[model samples]
Target: MGGGSFIEEVRMLGQGSTSSSWKWWAVIGGLVALPMCLCAFCMVSGLGVALLGTVGLMAGEVRPAREVAEQFLSALRDERWEDAYARCAPSFQGQLGGPEELARRHGGDRRPVEWSFSRWSVEVKNGVRQAHLEGTLTTASGEKYAFSIELRTRAVGSGEAWEIHAFTMD
Candidate 1:
């Protein structure tokens, strides 16, 4: 039986059966590639949308979460409470305390005269954009505080809108 099976396989190969035809392979390849191509297309399109949403386009220009964090930090450092609060997500604005309370907490002795931001990194995780910035906060009296900050952002609308979720400092 073993010898007969090996001989039958060789005979089929020599006979050039339909299974070995180029047309058959092409049809099989096309069928397999159809779903594969569709899946790739879906992934690419989804990634593109996520990127756009994360970067946030305005007036045909990109405004990334890092810039948002930069602006917020600058406002806080300058004691511009209203401006800083304006950039915060509504949910965050009224969370632990009011904007005025935040201003008092950060604006008093904690406020730095100027900041030096370095090692800026931006990444997106599960549709949330996280901006990591590390640097020094210098006070008017020449006091420097090394600090690390993370600014989070998330898409809110149909892949076209975004908001600053929150931020943490260390």
Candidate 2:
């Protein structure tokens, strides 16, 4: 008689038959086990996380508005003008001229040495998500000043990404 269904063939594969069922079992088992093995390796060796970040699978680790703001400020603190500029929304980018402008403005004595966010408010309006942050920033001269920043979520890949929409410091 003809070979049974695929599942039945797999079930009979270990019965020591000389039939082609072992080939089917090998193919099916490989298909099933390969992904499981890859996932386990990724989880154990941390490669999956690095791959996810490199491939833009999840927009890095700054998904939330607060995180985006903190990252932006951290970049400014480090005088990484391009990194800080990259966090600005497109409209904001227009106002910034470029990363060079960012450096010209925030670099040297104007750079923030440290900062902290004291209050946050988030809301979604007309399909646009926005976060408002208020905090204090310390300058390189050891002067503390009040600052407020607004962030908005924009479409990125299949999800949303936070970007600095506007900011003010005194």
Of the candidates shown, which would achieve the greatest lDDT relative to the real structure?
2
Model 2 steric clash total: 0
lDDT of 1 by residue, 102-147 (tens): 6776776677677766666666688766666677777556667777
lDDT of each: 0.67, 0.84
Those runs of model 1 whose alpha carbons end farther than 4 Å from true positions after fitting are: 1-63, 94-96, 156-170
Candidate 1, TM-score vs. the true structure? Answer: 0.51
Tens digits of per-residue lDDT for model 2, 85-130? 9999989999989999988888888789989888777777899988
Candidate 2 has an lDDT of 0.84
Q: Give the candidate number with the greatest TM-score.
A: 2
Clashes of each: 0, 0
